[model samples]
Target: MKTPACRIFLFPAMVCFSIIFLLSCTGQKIVSLKTLLMGMTDRTGITQTPSPWYKLIQASSYDRKSDKVGGKGWFANDDYTQFSGVDSSKGRKEYILLDSDGPGAIVRWWMTFAGEGSYDGIIRVYIDNTETPVLQENALKLLSGQLLAGEPLSASVSPETDLKMRGHNLYFPIPFLKHCRVTIECDSIRITANSRKPSIYYNICYRQYEKGTKVVSFSKDELLQNAELIKSTNETLKSSGTISDNLNLYSSSEPISAKDSINVNIRSKNSAISKITLKLSAFDTEYALRSTVLKITFDGFQTVWIPVGDFFGTGYKKTTSSTWNSRVDDQLKMESYWMMPFKKSCSVWLINYGDQIVKADLNIESSKYKWRSNSMYFGASWHEYHQIMTAGAESEGGTGKHRDINFADIKGKGVYAGDAVAVFNTVEAWWGEGDEKIFVDGEPFPSSIGTGTEDYYGYAWSRPEIFSHPFIAQPSGSGNFHAGLTINMRYRSLDAIPFMSSISSNIELWHWLPAIINYSLTSYWYVIPPYEINIK
Candidate 1:
C-alpha cells in the first residue's frame, strides 16, 4: 500500500540502516591517527569513540640471551640475530628484519648503518608469504621517508641527521592479514662514511591484533590512496588541532605543609580523562617535586602512584625537555596526554613529602566516553634505586638471579602502554647495554625481549642527542662524561602490549662500569578494574 515516493525514500533508508547495523555488529573499527582525530569533537564536547583498541609490540635486533645479567651454563649461549654482515661470496641479500605471522600492522621502522657502505642497500617487504616482495626499493630512500626522486613523506620519516651520524625513521602503517617478512640486502650499498665495513642497526615497531581481526594487507596502491589523508593528518597535528576540542579542568591546589597531601575528586558517569598537566613552585623545587607523590584512584580502585616528575617523564631535580605522550619544559611544567577512561568516579591527589610548603597547579580534561566491559582503567607505577651495580659472570650474585628492575607486575587482563626512565649514571661508559624482558600471561620466559636499552627507546649506538617522536623521545642525555642524568620516554599508540591474565616487565640493570648507578622508571598500562599491581 506504500506510494511510489515512499519506495524511493524507504529504499535508501533501509540500505543506510543495514549498513550501520552491519558495522555495529562487526565490533571495533580499526582507525589510524588520521581517522581517529577527524571530527572528534563538537560544540557540546568530544566524541565518545576517538581511539580504537589496539596493543603495541616491538621487534628489534638485541644481541643475545646469554648477554643477560644472570645467564649461566646453557643459558649463556650467544644468539646474534639482529643484523648480519655482507657475505663476501653471496652478498647480504635476504637479510631479514622481521618475520611474523599475524593479523597486525607495522606502525614504525627505524634503521641506521654502522661502519660504511650501507646507503645503497636494497630493502624488500613480503606480506602474506607472497613469493614476491610487496615492496622492493633502496634502503636509504625508503627509510629516509622519501619516495622516487626524494619526495619527502613527512608523515613517515622522523630521523636524526648530524654531521657524524645519520639515522632513518619511518612511520607508515603497513597492515597485513597473514604474514610479514622484511629483509635488506646490504652488499651493494655504500655509506658516506670513510670506513670500509658496515653493519645494520634497526627496529620494527608493530601492533598485533586479536585472532579474528580483519585487516587489509598493505600495498603500494593503498599507500598512494592514503597519501592525501596522511598529509592532512600531519598538518592537523602540527597545528595542534586534535586537542583543541578538549575541555580543560585546571586548578591550583591549596598550599600543603610537609607530610600533607591534597585530593581532588571528580565524579561523572560515562566520561574519560584526556590530559593532565602540573607545575610546582617551592623553596626547593627539585627536592619538593621529587618528594611529592601523585596518587590516582578510579572507580573505587587505586591505579597510579608516582613522583610528580617521573610521572611526567622527567628526573626530579634535573632540567629536562622532551616531546611525546609526556613532556617536561625547562620552566618545570609537566604534561601528559594518556587517555584514561572511567565510568563512575575518579580521585587524584598529591602528597608532599618534602619539608617546605609546596604549591601545585593541576589541569585535567575529560570527554564523553562509553566504556564497555572490555574497557580498562589506566594505571601507572614508579620505582627507583639509588645505586644499582653492574653484573659480570662471577660478580655480585648469580646471573639469572640478579634481579632485573621491575617495571610492572600485574594480575588480570590488561595492555602495557609505555614507560619513562631516569638514568643517573655515576660512570658514563654506556650504561644502556641492559636488555628488556617482558613476560606476558604467566609465561615462564619473556615473550617480548629487547636488544639494548637504547634500542628499546628508538635510537642507536647509545648516542647522547635529543630526538623526539610521536611515540618515543630522549629528552635528556649524558652530555660530557657519564656523570649526568638521562631521561627517556616511549609512548605506544598502535603497538601496546596486551596480556590476558598477567604480565611482568623488567629491564636488566646491566651497566658498563662497576660503580653504582641510579635508575628510576615510571610504568604505564591499562587494566580491568579490581586488579592488583606489584612494582619494586
Candidate 2:
C-alpha cells in the first residue's frame, strides 16, 4: 500500500559516523551472515535505504480530458466517465495510481463490492507521501438482490443494470498518481445476502499517466526475477521427480503435438485413480501448488474435474497452453497434483478403472503465484524474504508446519534436499511478471512449497499463489475494532470476476469453483554481497 523512498539529499556528516547506512561495507566488519540477513531485510519503513526510490499514491478525485485516451478499463460502468465531486459526492469521480508520478502513469481503482451498499462503499488506501492530496470522486451504484458464492449475495451494474437487475457498485475511474492516497464516498447501501467468505477483490491498477515518464508499476528488477522463477520451479520439480504444475505433458510413450491431448477413460470396473496429488519438495523451493484439477471419464461419465478454488489454497491452471477442469466421481473422491510435463519426461500417473486413458495429457503453461506487494514489489536481497519464505501461520488463515529449512537439516529433511547455500549475483524473480527462483550455490535453489487445497492458497487472494506479496507486506496488525484476530493489511485481490452482466452465470461466468489454483509467484534468493543493518 505504501512505497519506499531513497534519501532525498546527501549528508556528508553520515560519512564521518560509521552509520552502516552511510557506507557499503567495512574492510573487516564482523557479523554473522544470518544475523546480517535478518537486519538488512527489515523493510518496515518508508526510506529504509535512501533517496531515488518509489512509492504508491492514492486518489480522492480527478478529471480526464473529454478528448484524451491513454488507458481503458473493462468494468463496463458509466461511473468511469469523469473525475468529479469538486465538493459534493453527486457527480465527482475518484481515481488512484500506483506509481512514482513518472510519465504516463495511470490507475484504475475500485472498492470491494459485497452486493450490499446502503451508503458510500468504503475506500481505504496505503499512502506514501502524505503531503499530496488524495483525489476524491463520488462514484455511485444501485444494488439488486442477488448473490454469488465467494462474492456478495447482491448483484448490480452488470449485464446492463435494469429493473430486473441492479447496479451493485460505483466503479471509479482508474486513478492517476504523482503522490498517493485512497478516496471513498458512497450513500444508501443495501445488502441482500452475506458474502460466504471474505472476497480478495481490491481492484486497482497502475499505469504511466504523465508524458515521457513511464511510471514503472512494479520494479523492473523484481519483474525479471519473477520471470526466472518459472525456470527455477521447473528445475526443482524435475529434479524431485515431480513435474511443474504449469507444464502439460503426455506419457513419454506417446507423442504430443501442439495443444494435443489423449483420452483418459475410467471404466466402471477399473481401479481408477480416485485421487492423485504431487507432493512438492519444500526444502529447496517455496512454490506451493494450488487449485488442483483433473480431467477423465469414470463410470461412463466424462467431465472436467475441478475442486473448490481454495482447496487448501493451492492448485494449477492452464498458464501457457493447457486448460484443465476437474471430473468428479461421487462415490470416489480423489484429489492430487499429478505430474504432467510439457515434453518427454519418462512417465506419468494413470487411473485405470475399466477406463483406458488412451493418453495422459498435461497442460504446460505459465500460471503465477501473485503476492500483493512485498514490503515493496521488485527484487530483494537474499537477506529479504527470510521470514516469509520460512513457515509460520497467517493471523487469519492460521499457521502451518513452519519447517525451519537450511543446510543443517539437509540430510534429514530429504535426499534431494540441498547441501550448501550461497548468494546469487542473479535474483529469482528477475522478471516483472513476478516469477522468481531461488539459488543454492550457483545452481537452481532446490526447494518447493506445497499446500493442499486445504491450506496455503485456500482463501481467495490469501493463498500464496495469487496475492501473497510479503516482501512489500507485513502482518495485518490488530485494531481495537476487531479483537483476538488480525487480517493481513497488505494482501489484496479483487472479488473474482463479478457478473459481467445478469446474463453471466456463476458456473459459466465467474468460474466460482473454489478450486482454481489462481497463481503461484516464485522468485529465487541467494546470499550474495553480504550486507547488514541495525534494525532498532
Candidate 3:
C-alpha cells in the first residue's frame, strides 16, 4: 500500500502554520521560485528532514500494461502517447499529461518525441484552480532551453545527438498551492501502435507536500521576479569547482605501493568537509583509477566505500564532466563537493588494490558547522558485476529474463542524493532497456519507477553522444550503442528523496541481446548514525 501523506507530518497543524508565518509577515509562507532555487544549492538543507516532509512522486509515460506485478504485458515497450484522460470542456480537446491535487512542486521534467510533427505541440500548465494556463509554449521549446531558463536547468543532452533523438529536460521547480494540471494540445498525437502521428515520451518528477502546507503557485510573474536569482544559481551550479574562501584547506601528496593505503585525518570538533579533490598518476592510469578505492569514515562510522573513478563520476576513465556535486577536469583531477558533516572526527583513505604503485595528491577543505538534531553524514557505495549475462526482452525476440540489479539497500533515515552507472558492453547492441525501481521506507511497491534506463538518466533513444550538465551528465557514451564503456550520472537537489527508514534502489538489466557485460553502480546519499548499507 502507498504510504499515507498524513502520517508523514509529525508536528501539529498549528506548528506548520507557525513556521510558515515566521518566513513572512503575510500569514502564509510562499514557496516561490526563489525559495526553491536557493534550496537547490543549499547543502545543509538536504540533511534536515523538513517538519512536514514532502514525498517524491514520478509521473511518466511508462507502459500502462505494467500496472500489476506478474501480470501480462508487464514488460511491454509501448511507452508512448498514454494519457490520464482527455479534457474537452474548453471547446477543444487537450490530452492530460498530469493532473494532481497539490501542495506540491514539480522538480524535474524530461521528455522526447519521435515520428512526424511531434515537437510542434503546445504544452500548457494550469495551476491553483485557475482556468487560464500559467504556461503555454511549444513543448520542445519549453523543455529544451529555448523558452524558459537556459542551459543546465533547461537543456537537451548531447549537442552531438540528432535533434529529434535527444532528450529534452527542465529542472526548474514549478510550485503549486491547490492543484496542478499539465496538458498538451497536439493534433499530431495518435495512440495507435502503428499510427503515423508522433510518439511522445516523458518522465515528470514532483514533490507532494503534506496537506495545509502553504505553496505559491508558479506563474510568469514569479519567473520574472526570480530572474536574477535564477541566473546566479545557474552560475553557481556551473562553477562547482570554485573553492570557497571560508574553508580551510589541507593538502597531501603520497605514493601508495601495491596493496597499501594512505590516510588523511581531520580531528576538528565541529567541522564539515566542504570539498575533496584527488589526482592520481600511475603507469596504467585507467587501471589505477578503477583499483584505487576511496573510503571515508565519519565520526567513527564508515559511510563511503567506492573506487576513485566511479565515486567521481568518470567510471574507470578520465572523462571530463561537471555537475553540482562532482566534477572531473581535463588533467584527470576529480573533485567532489558533497557536504559531509562530522561531530568530532573524520578519516579519509585511498587504498590501491592493484599491483602497480600509484601516486596521489589530495586536497581536503573544511568549514565550521554547527551540529543539529537533523544533521546527517554523507555516504557512497559501489559494486561491480563482471561478465554479467543478459537475456533479451521478449519484445525483441529473445527470452524476457530481465532481472533487477540492486544499486544500494540503505537502512536508516537518510536522503538519497544521486547515483552513477558504468557499463562495459561486449556487443554492439543497445544494452539499456531497463527501468529504475526505487522503494522508500519499506513500501510494498516502488514509489518511484521509471520508463527506461536512458530516460531515468535524463536522455533518450540510446544515442551515444556525450553531454554534461549541472545535475545530469553522460561523460562517455561509447558503450551505449556499441561494445565500449559508457558512464551516466544524475545528481539531485530539489528532487532528493528523504527516507525515514530505508531505501532500496534497483534497475533492471534489460539488454537487447544475449551478451556478457560489465556493470557497476555507485550510489551517493546522506544518513544519520546507526545506519547500515548493503553495498561494500
Error of 2 at 253 (Å): 4.8
The 10-residue segment of model 2 with minimum total lDDT is 500-509
User: Model 2, 188: alpha-carbon shift in Å?
Assistant: 8.8
Measured against the true structure, the TM-scores of the candidates, in listed sequence, are 0.81, 0.24, 0.93
Q: Judged by lDDT against the true structure, how good is candidate 1?
A: 0.65
Candidates' RMSD to native:
9.4, 22.1, 6.2
List the candidates ranked by lDDT, beginning with the highest.
3, 1, 2
lDDT of 3 by residue, 399-454 (tens): 88778898999999989989999999988789998888888998876778778888
Model 2 stretches with alpha carbons more than 4 Å out = 1-110, 113-118, 121-182, 186-359, 362-536
Best of the two (1, 2) by TM-score? 1
Say which candidate scores most in TM-score: 3
lDDT by residue for model 2 (31-133), tens: 2111112222221211111111212222311112211111232111111212222133336433222223432222223332233342334332323344323
